[model samples]
Target: MTSIYYIQVEDRNSMDGNRSNTLAGLKNNFAGEKEVLVFSNHATEITEKYAQSGVKTTIYQNDAYTIANFDAVLTKLKQIFRSKTDYLLVFDNDSLGSSLGSRIAALLDITFVADAKKITETPNLTVTQDIGATSAKRVIPLAKQAVITFSCNGVAANEPAKVDVSSWSLNEQTKQQYRQAKTAGNGLAFAKVVLAGGKGLGSQQQFKPLMKLAQKLNASVGATKAVTDLGWLSPERMIGISNLTVKPDVYYAFGISGAVQHTSGMNKSKQVIAVNTDPEAPIFKLANYGIVGDANKVISQLNDLL
Candidate 1:
């Protein structure tokens, strides 16, 4: 069987610098001559670097972005599997395309790996997931087919190379429930300042004051899993595993205990300021500035000052 590098590319119009590096690394690490297959839902086509790398490139682009879902992607994958030997499917951490790839693997009853920070494939494929203080490692013998999602920094997706190639086609169908809701704000992804509330926030009413403060600062508001799960805040505002990950200039956490799951998403912030009444809170350990004080009181003071 031949080894095929199947990548799900998002931001289809233009390739992200991070993903560009990832493609380079995969090509460099491949054992011998392998096919590079890229997939996208958008109408945008990639650059010509893929073919220039001396590898055969086949791009599967959806002619239109209508009624898209994981099942639609799955339908397409099944078609390609028949002709190809086996595939090493790769996706970016928490990406839409990656999510689809995972679902496709599940439906096909194939092995899948998520949030892999590091991957080395020599004698066998070893994937490492660094979850804060502890790390998990797994080795999978190169299989007939498998799915893997790559971490942003964990695997150094920012390689010093560019290989963007793409094209279009009319794709598949949607199986899941579909509703058109308002699009989520691109705050954590683009905000210079973010104010994140945690489980310490007693109620939804109490969260309003922090939201007001964020607005005054022209900042975006984020929340911990506990608060979001409690239905106190929107899931789009969540910052953690299986949610949106952010790296802002200044990250402000109020009433948050700084759990590893939450911190894993935001620890990359340029500066972190944590406010919790508990002096023993874990957030203080990673915060650039820590305050052992009531979160509401501090927000009030900051609000008055602003």
Candidate 2:
């Protein structure tokens, strides 16, 4: 029996971000027995696209947090795995499992593999997960009954998953739980001010001032693709052509070399302020205010003032 590859799409509200290339990397890599289960309140054209791809797609009429009920998605997975030919494959995506999937893996006690960069077929399957932003990786082998989570860092393919759609409604009990658990959120979309950092921030330690600055102004933190790719920041914060497209009232770019791909995401900002040592960085062209200096030093001084 062939092992099943399941891609879980948890939130549909933010689906516009990557609906085109959603899970394309994993689908292209797995290449066999794919199922995309979306737990969302809204339906989009991609559902039909999945059907065209000849994959199995399921949608639940609820958000991901509610779908994570012990008697819900986890129970459904339990039912699927009863056949011994099926398993779960979720990218630790911001849209999907970053947390919900891990909880399910822990609940099921499945041989959960995290951060798998690539999976290879060598008589038996081997999973390679990256440990560092630059090079190091850890390889894991597939098990008969395993639950895997991947980091959606690779470039996803344009082809949508091939699948038919199946819809499920949320239970009343879960609805109450969701209502009680939900809290106030003023996420990046709502942030009037955004203090964005790029790979030029240097290291994880250097990112401290950026965060401190953000807190001072109550601004949200954004990043470039390179920063997210290097594991210094979450893919959720990535501001780029393929990631987040932010239009805050004020957007500040620090240490950002201003790649076109990165700048495009923030070009819509009401006021752009770019800080870079190089006077000729492409980011400066778009900046209403440009400060040509060492980012670390400038940020340090700004933090002191704040």
Candidate 3:
């Protein structure tokens, strides 16, 4: 029987519900054909969710919190692979999955796809990826055994559920190690709305209107690399590449050109609206609705609409 391994990240807060999305996608895609295995930190709440989604097997690790300890998790994965040559879908909790995915594939001597969005099986296994600035789609043919780092957008279709109780034990030493390494940070992923700015906003002074609009909506502020690079905004506010991935209920892009790197981080938003002067700006292509005009003017009108 073909098997599917869902690499569940222990740091759910950091992933911004990405784990849930990935698991849901797997369940929807595989359905009755394959067995689903969820590897997580054994958080009772999260584990129960996966189990309810029809995940037949669940593996819990004690020290799965930090990026430094991912190798230990990989070791256990190797053991699972030894028994069955399964197609492993490595769902990133953050960008950390990108670093560890290839290593896991190398260890198993299987081809690995980075940031893959879709997987299909015909006579051969086929994978699709969104790469480069154009969000170009590429396909790769794979043999039976392969590892894939799935994109969050591709897996957002699955809905998380509250599962019946099924517990697993972990080693005491690993549990102690994880507890000592836990870190604290903001929960930006759970934000209801995000007001993001870009270089097209003109100057640092222009950011005030965006901030004002964000405040009116009670949304957190986000920025593109251009604004951050110019030092007009802090790097922490940047939302692409090395920055945080967001999936807020609503994402407002002001003067952003919609570079692929920037779009990749927030494409999972429930609704995307872009305000830009350039009618052909790349960001407008992905937006659900767009207004081609001065951001300042649009913002002022938006304030009135709100």
Q: After superposition, how far is residue 212 of candidate 1 from its true place, in Å?
A: 34
Lowest summed lDDT across 10 adjacent residues in model 1 is found at: 152-161
Model 1 lDDT, full chain set: 0.66
Cα-based lDDT for every prediction: 0.66, 0.64, 0.65
Q: Cα RMSD to native, each candidate? A: 12.3, 13.7, 11.3
Clashes of each: 3, 6, 0
lDDT (Cα, 0-100) at 165 in candidate 3 = 35
**Order of candidate numbers by lDDT, starting with the best:** 1, 3, 2
**Where in model 2 is the C-alpha error above 4 Å?**
10-22, 44-46, 52-54, 61-71, 85-88, 93-96, 132-134, 152-162, 172-284, 287-306
Candidate 3, 140-201: lDDT as tens digits = 88666777777532222223443433333332255323322121113455576788888988
TM-score for each prediction? 0.48, 0.52, 0.51
Question: Which 10 consecutive residues of model 2 have the lowest summed lDDT?
Answer: 177-186
For candidate 1, report its TM-score: 0.48
